[model samples]
Target: MIIELESVFNTEGLKLPFDYELDLSAIQVSGYSPIAQPVRVSGKVENKAGIVNLTGNAQVIYTAPCDRCATEVSKEYNFPLEHTLVVALESGENDAFLEVPNLRLDLDELVEEDVNLALPSKYLCNEECKGLCMSCGKNLNEDQCNCKAPVDPRFAALLDLLDE
Candidate 1:
């Protein structure tokens, strides 16, 4: 969705509202598509005292397998989209503002970037997720495993002293 901001940029106090659904099902995160539903974006671009700003919210439901236990987990996320729109930059490079060359803003692209940054680096079923046991390959969260971890040779002397 390309939003033409010609009027908003020229006229002070002018506001351009936008609401749409963005399809990002093809996006891959950590080798899987977690976003099964369309992203809901609702916001407005307005010029306040000659400065144009875009503000909105992007809502999505992400469903993916947990990183540790591989259990499926569904989570809802809402990311606030806020950026200052500028026609041109005064310096060499600036990350604080978004430059619109022809006064056309790709709303979907901006929203997608915000969603990706808001997503967690690693998804887990729960905070205290006890992953599978390395020895027996059993889920430690469901039940305790009988396999005893191998003791290092350096720690063997400490174990013998405790037994005596």
Candidate 2:
């Protein structure tokens, strides 16, 4: 999803409106593959005195397994994706600007990064998800387990004394 920025770069104070679909199939999460969806890329790119600027958002709906309950869950994300594009050698390798080759912007890659950065470290089906039971592998939210609960190792000594 590379777009040519040469024309946009030629004129000072020039602005170009762009909209495209971003594919997120390549990004990987811990236990689940994010369902590939077309993320919206909408914004205006401008050339201000030889500097390439972009102002817009990368929006998408991502589906993945819940980290706690293992249930399939979907999350909505709309992250701000703005960057100052700079020529690699000319910018002196600063983190404040994004460097590009051949005056092109990888729109898909940029949006993908934004989506990844916005994703939560942990995903839960809900705030109250009870998760799966260790004893019988039953979903605790659906059914309660009657199996003896495993005592914490720290409390094992107290349980041994009580048995005696």
Task: Please give the CA lDDT of all the candidate structures.
Answer: 0.89, 0.78
Q: Who wins the TM-score comparison?
A: 1
Could you estimate the TM-score for every candidate?
A: 0.85, 0.75
C-alpha-based local distance difference test score of model 1: 0.89
Candidate 1 structure quality by residue, lDDT tens digits, 4-54? 999999999999999999998988987899998998999999999999999
> Top model by lDDT, which number?
1
Q: How many backbone clashes does candidate 1 have?
A: 0
The candidate 1 region of ten consecutive residues with least summed lDDT is 149-158
Q: Which stretches of candidate 2 lie over 4 Å from their true place?
A: 48-50, 89-93, 148-164
Once fitted onto the true fold, the runs of candidate 1 whose alpha carbons sit more than 4 angstroms away are 149-164
RMSD of each: 6.1, 5.0
Superposition-based RMSD of candidate 2 using all C-alpha atoms, in angstroms: 5.0
